[model samples]
Target chain A: MSDRQLADWRNHALNLESEVNKVVVGQQTPIRLITTSIFARGHVLLEGDVGVGKTTLLRAFTRGIGGGYQRIEGTIDLMPNDLVYHTYLGEDGKPHVSAGPLLMSGENLSVFFFNEINRARPQVHSLLLRVMAERSLSAFNSEHYFPHMIVFADRNQVEKEETFEIPSAARDRFMMEIPIVVPNDDAIMEALVFDTKFHNVDALVNTVQPDVLQFDQLNAFSNVIQSSVEASDTLKKYALNLWKATKAPLDYGVKVSGVDMNRLVLSGASPRGMSMMLRAARVNAWLNERTAVLPEDIHAVFHSTVAHRLVFSPVYEMRRTEIAREMLQGIVNAVAAP
Target chain B: MKTMIRIFYLLLGLNVAPQTAFAIDSQNLPDVPPGIVTIRTIDPVKLVGYTVGDIIEREVILTIKAPYKLIETSLPITGYEKRYKGQVIGIELKSVSHTKKENKDSATFDIKLAYQIFTNNVVAKNAALGPEYLNLINTKDSKDLVKYRIPNLDIAISPIAIFGQVKIENNMSPLRGPLLLSNVKENKWLKVSIGFLALSLLGLLYILGQRAWLPRMGGTFAKTHRKLRKLPQSPEGLKLGVAAVHESLNTTASMSVFSNNLGIFLAQKPNFSPMATELQQFFSLSRQVYFEPNAAHGLGTNPQQWLQSFVRRCRDCERGLTPETSTQKSGS
Candidate 1:
């Protein structure tokens, strides 16, 4: 792709960012991550406290990227088939079979968001994982494919009781796990709390222009960006260093104040996860108006892409977020940038 | 013309028996010499208050009538140990001297002797100095060998007193001893400790100089970090921050850090691998602030903080503070 073409793509991404920001104020990180994930053609896991605009951010992206959007509220009683088919009584007291959200959207389902996904059963999670991994499902004696589908799942970390936390296998399928943190700036907080438009979620989401970005063109755009972006040999070495640090930070001379490097990470980020992260990084580079991928671009999407893929030792699992941040910082601090 | 005279000498022995009375035997030699010699001891023969290691000295003067020459062979010599009644007296003769002078009618002889006492013999502590016989050969008449005696110079040598007690106040009190002579070991330890202190001082100075704590000692990134720390919250300060990073990076990489060879530079110095992204963004921010004049780099919050942190990391890289950068120094 030409520089001008990349610029046009970047402009579209900026527009999508602005459109999403209209409803989700000061959530620029989530918006950029979600946009990059969409361009990378990978699923995302959204995690944040309640009322921090996870749903709103997802809705804004769904509306901004013109596609059929589907949302499923997870519950303990949710069954595996609930995502593909629903059977209920009709007015004539006879049973009726209809397509569920996953099947309903069919080929055009570009964005599928599962809210409070941990509330769902493990069976439901396994089914979602299949849909996420394959992007197609055989339901009602028919195979349905979602060629442009990108799933967004949210887990309520506040109340974890009676919740079936997403397993590591399912979690690793996600390209990024973007946390929707509440805006800490006074202006953003004031706008969120005092502004009438922010009080109404539906109206707030409506402020963004529908189909501000062409969702179908993202796959091609992602391919062009990945192929065109220059990752120098040194940058690859830098990435390898980062990879090694994650696997064996002790070998790289990484030191986190209280955590033992040898025991910090049980398993390093997967190679598939690394590639996905690189893909997202390229898109981020394109968004930054660069034809060549820079180190910042990689860092921009680094933690989101790789944090969930890393398995911590059981002892550090409870303090994963705190220790993981340190461990990642250690990696960042341990490797030299070009 | 000189008159002829004959002299006779008398010697007496001392007794230190349990009876506290002094006894002397009076002997009269008829016409032995109407010119008998009279010997007077300058130092008293009966001595007092002599400690165990004390030396006893005595000077005796003998006067003889005319026509007499003192015998030189009668002088006491070193190694002459005195004994009392077959028991060893503590005194060992150190030296003795004999001198004679002629006068109008008489010849006077002076004799001097000294002794050092070593051990404290309990039986001999109060004993008298023992007597020894000397043969005085005549100078004129070579065949004449007269037996002469020097009376013992008695002195009281008290055993070294033990009148006081050594009271120890604490466990750290010094132990009594035959004092040790250890100046050699003390000198060696002193040299070692001084050398250690000197090395420590030198190391501290090196660190201070390397850290640019000393005046005019500019190390790598020393100026950069200092300027960043003292940077004012102004546009000019921001420019300075940018320029500081640029200059330091160029110096660290030993070349320009354009986008093309950034990898090559970092590859050459893998120590900077961890800071790959931060350095990239630092260049971006520099470009934005200086070239494009964009006040904001979309760095989320606190652009000044971002600049400061970037500058600090840049400084850390320059100084090899980070582990990745530290490897560079260690490799060499």
Candidate 2:
């Protein structure tokens, strides 16, 4: 694609963000990040509380970017087979088989939201991890490819009982783990409480214009953006240092109070995580109408892209949400850019 | 002839007794019994240049036999001048005191006498502390009075100046006003001390003050600019320059400084806020040099020069000075 065509698509991507913003109030950053993920062709993991509008935000995004959509509620007894297909009783008193949400959407599936993902069994998570990692699955003695699909999963942090924690390997497969926080502004809070439009989530999500971005063309355009956005040698070194800091923050002088930095990380961001970070940063740069990737671009996606991939020691894992946030902040604060 | 000369010497000794001997006439007074009184005197060391008001001190240690005690009233009184040939002399007894030590068989007296010169002359002249006659009474025989004498002290006195016209040519300058001390050296030292104090104050201002008028006022960025100036325009030199700036900003912010959290850095150290735009440009230039070396710097033809200028402005900002806004450019 030419620069002009990319510029045109950049406008469209921004338009899609504005359309989602129209329904999802005070979530501009996450919306921008989601837009970047779409163009980067990476899956997202939305984390939030029980009623902080995580589903509403994703639904609004699906509305703007028209494609096959699928929703599934994770449950304790959910089996891997439940995602492929399900067996049901027909009126003829015979067993009837129908494709499940994963296979029902087929290759055109672009947004697959698994709500309360932690409530699902590990077996279901394993199957989903394979699909998320390879974008292909094997079932029914055949193979299925979901080249255009991007998974969006959200789990409430308020609950932990009977919920299986997503393991490190599964978490690493995701391109980003975005935190969905309710807007803290008093006016926005007041609007959320009393605004009539915000009361009906379905109507609010439906308010977004549909199909502002062509979902099928996003893959090709993602490649174009990744190729066109130039990253300087200096930026590469900086990004390399950022990656190294995640692994060995002690060497970079990254310190968090009341935590031993040496034993903080069992593992750093993986190579794939760093690549996805750069890919998303490039999209961010392109979205900002720049040709070269700046450190600011990396920062825009740093915590979202890299924080989840860090495996803290089991001692710190209980406070992963707080410590991971501090560790990432300390990394950026300690590692100098060019 | 030898016997005649001996007789003359004996007569002279009789006329003027030895220094510590009694020199009183015994015609009208009963003489002290032989071995009854003995005197030893200590006088002033300087014997010449006795001008008016010069004091001569003499101490007499007298030992007298038992039953013969010194009558205190017989001691010489202050303000008394001795007579020689019925003429009052230039020396006056200023003070007299005595302390006594008594034993079973004998008693000793320690006498201290002070005399003052009351006269001067046009020429040097001889002077004397005249003799003192002290009486001793026998306690057993009240009617018997014995006289003991303290010999005179001999010294020379000189005038302060000659009596007649003195020539200025005789190694003497005309009398001038009271002496005034020269302060040329002191004045020179005072000026030097003031100069050093001013220099010390200026040095303190340069080191500790927040002004940019002096070198090293903004030490971090100033040092960075110095390093950048020496760097070549080569790719490696550019990286080194950018690294120098990064280190400087890190030190200024007291943490690793990147373009993203620059606002926080500025808020922490408001001294660098004026060059916020230039600082942003520096990060962009740094990124291009170290991270995006292939892309054109887009900071005019010589990006190294641009970096030097940018760091210079940052130095200004670090010094709490307003950065020159005219040089602001988009680093992209």
Best candidate according to DockQ: 2
Tell me, what's the RMSD of every candidate? Answer: 18.0, 10.9
**Model 1 Cα shift for residue B100 (angstroms):** 31
What would the per-residue lDDT of candidate 1 be over residues A1-338, giving only the tens digit for each residue? 68788888788889889888777888888888988998889999988898788998888888988889999999999998888888999999999999999988778898999999999999999888888889889876788888888999998777878888677788899999887777789998888888888888998888888988887887787888888776765467767888877899898677777777777788898888889988998888778776566666777888999888889888877777667777776676556654
Report, in order, each candidate's fnat.
Answer: 0.00, 0.76
Candidate 2 residue-wise lDDT, B1-332, digit = tens: 99999999998887777743644343357778888888888987777767888888989999988789888778888989877777876888999898989988889889999988888887667777867788888999987888877787878877778778855355232322334699999999999999999999986565445445775574888878878878888877877888898899899888888877889999998977777776777776776666555555557666677778788778767766666664535442
**Ten-residue segment with the worst summed lDDT in candidate 1 chain B?**
B23-32
Candidates in order, TM-scores: namely 0.55, 0.70
Show the colliding residue pairs in model 1: A335-B273, A335-B274, A335-B275, A336-B272, A336-B273, A336-B274, A337-B272, A337-B275, A337-B276, B271-B324
Show pairs that collide, candidate 2. Answer: A232-B291, A232-B292, A233-B291, A233-B292, A234-B290, A234-B291, A235-B291
- lDDT value, residue B98 of candidate 2: 89
Candidate 2: misplaced stretches above 4 Å? A91-93, A139-141, B1-197, B200-219, B233-236, B292-302, B313-332
State the TM-score of candidate 1 restricted to chain B.
Answer: 0.40
List per-prediction Cα lDDT, in the order shown. 0.73, 0.85
Q: Tens digits of per-residue lDDT for model 2 on A16-96?
A: 988888888888999899999999999999998888889999999898888899999999998999899989999999999
